[model samples]
Target chain A: MNLGILIAGLLTLAIYSFLYKDNPVYRAAESLLIGLSIGYTLVLFWQSTLFDKLFYPLLREHGIWLTIPLILGLMMFSRLTRKWSWLSRIPIALMIGAGAGAAIPAMLYARTLKQVSATVHPLIMENGGFDISAVVVVIGVLTTLAYFYFTREHKGVMGKMARVGTYFLMIFFGATFGYTVMSRLSTLIGRIDFLLGDFLHLLK
Target chain B: MNSNKTRWIIYSTLLIVVVLSYLLGINLITHPSPEVQKSYTFIENLPESSVVMVSFDHEASSLPEIQPISLILLRHLFRRNLRVVGLSLFAEGTAIGYRTLTKVAQEYGKQYGHDYVFLGFKPQHISAILGMGESIRGVFPEDYFGNKIEEIPLMRKIRNYDDILVVISIADGDRTMQWIEYAGAKYHQRIMAGLTAAMITTYDPYLASGQLSSAVGGLKGAAEYENLYGRRGMGNRGMVAQTAAHIFIIVLIVIGNILYFKNRSKGGGNR
Candidate 1:
């Protein structure tokens, strides 16, 4: 058995041992995974982002314009200081403003306008048959939106629509839950494959 | 039985079933869902030598579900002789992306700088996406291995999003939304995603709007792509175990519900 596989197998078993009871073995494995992940991420940040994007530009390319961001990034460290903690807010505000400014128009076109247009498609298809699914989607979107209309109490026709909306919401949630299970199960199957095929050589 | 004992029994049973499914090579025939088929056909119809950017936007934790998706797609792209430019938006995905790309590229006998180039991870994903619209080399001066982008033969032709045919963001989270919003909506890049099963529904609206060209989701999606690619891989094998595990869970749920109802009728205390 390869040493790497052996170590991986041990860690897998250690993590699975938690099903019986939490123990030092599981704790050790958990800590190792967390530590290794953090270490890897820090190195990647330095090599990929900070070193290439920041340091190399400042030193080698002599891109003096890069210092503005450099200063702003450094101001983020003011969060650690008692008196200068307010300085951190400058960068935070800038990030939030820039992010939102960049995001809003795209979100409007991609998420809002496009979604609304899709929902409110032509009731009749080009082939001339009534687009039943399109009508259902339009109704579903309207009723669901109405359900969140808190200004008026849900009663009479509104109550009926809200009830229908609840059913649609329930179906959506159920489908999401089912897929979530499949997602997690796929992860489990992956580990099982690694253990049997890679680690133990129990399977081809 | 004690709840802890019951839990242990359940876990052991689940593990055994999955392992046995793998060992026995249990095959479950599956048809490609429409969404997955759409994604397959999108790639299938791509012109040869078209540049495709694959953003590995996931981490190690979600690798089990997402890796097969990435691998299958990469295989298909390489098989078609497509120029793949790999990059990552997430820090954790940087190394994971490189490893997966390298492994698949080797299997296809692809040269690194000529056939595929990994641009590594970029911070501020929104800016990076926009920057790629202007100049990919400007955003990533150095490839993942610290080689100048200008030196890479593949990178020479690919200057911006316009030069690329499509961008596939294989992700576990909502990073695909950023790709769609910035890269697809703003830059008019054809964007697709290979998402974890849990995230498929979230992108349905984008798919409907044609903002996202298509998406392959979860292990099932990978399996579909593998079938399309005419090769059986981890996706096929993993699906068997997944089916077995799902059946096991369903059986357990039914039995538990039956037992609970029976006990309730007998006025037994909740346990």
Candidate 2:
């Protein structure tokens, strides 16, 4: 346990050192992480999809039909040989085509139609209540959307509105940036805390 | 000339104080435990034994956020005796989500087919979702563990979105919105979303529109869930770290503004 803790603490410090200066230690840790992830993903893809969906079905009942994907999959590895790499395009094309076919209609309905339609309504209080939040949201959405209008020129009232929209866009963008940074920093902190708290037992 | 050094010392001292305050206990106290209250209200309202579609639509990178929610919600559902069918829009979440689901389900003595089933991920995400809406079995011919759909008793009963009483989409991107627009809007699956805090406001419209029944936003949302389940998990820890980090950033920003004003007052060389 002592040895485990020491090594973890060292690795955490090593990775964190990248923030101060770029060096071989950080590079080695980063590369190892990438390699391990790739190795793990291959094993999972085989166990979850290839073995369960393809292999098991072939051996039991589906037989020849399953062989088609298996052979096409094997053909994919032929790209390792420079001369035969072109042949791999056949399977890749089919995969891309199927992916595109799936994405297009779904993107149209889910993203284009639904999202735009969702933006059209502003909440209004029925009787006594006032929807202040909804009003602010409507103003924000319209302004932000207008800020993205590059095809037209801004002047007078239009220019002022566009400028106000730009401010809202910046705040939104800044908040998003802040959140993303926090999320990433939390991951880094987790690793560091493990090194400090659990691995090093320093904090404890 | 001496004041410059004194100013530096004062700034660094302030930095250290803020950091210490944030790290030690200040943050935990400030960030209220509203998460528990919100999640409790959500679960309390949901009907017992209702079929719910659990979209574990997150990558391995987001396991920190997605995993706890998966475990806690799984326990909550199983304990409530609700039927769950799991699917992932993201490739990386499939395996991680499966392990989490199985681990929690086993702890609760929940049987796989009788209580929950994991319909593994498909690369054709939009097509897969549309297919599942049309036919659940057609989209996932077998469960993640390679069990046939027919053999899984839970899968046998679940046919489409309409059968699902609630749709819980835990995601890092607009994918949750996709589920809301497609399944929730089209099929009227009572929807709830759990998303990264940063991305939550983007979906506020959906929440206000009544498209989403409720939402658990980011680590706060997860923490709320852990509170409701009466279990301390990653979210609570994350909130601690997040609170620390936010305070750090806020302090940095203040220092920056001070430096700007100070330089302006002195008429510094650099513009």
Which candidate comes out best when scored by lDDT? 1
User: Which ranges in model 2 have alpha carbons more than 4 Å from their true place?
Assistant: A1-14, A47-102, A122-124, A192-204, B1-40, B185-190, B210-213, B264-271
Let me know the TM-score candidate 1 reaches against the reference structure.
Answer: 0.96
Clashing pairs in 2: B35-B224, B36-B224
TM-score of chain A, all candidates: 0.94, 0.79
**i-RMS of candidate 2:** 4.4
Poorest stretch of ten by lDDT in candidate 1 chain A: A112-121
Predictions in order: lDDT: 0.90, 0.71
Per DockQ, the best of the predicted structures is 1
Q: Per-residue lDDT tens digits of candidate 1, residues A1-204? A: 889889988999999888878899999999999999989888887887788788988999999999999999999999899999999999999999999998899989988887787777899999999999988898889789778888989999998898889988988898899999999999998888888889878876
Model 2 lDDT per residue over B29-88, tens place: 323344346555667667887787788888766665556566777778788888888878
* Candidate 1: Cα lDDT at B122: 90
Chain B TM-score, all predictions listed: 0.95, 0.84
Superposed model 1: Cα runs more than 4 Å off = B263-271
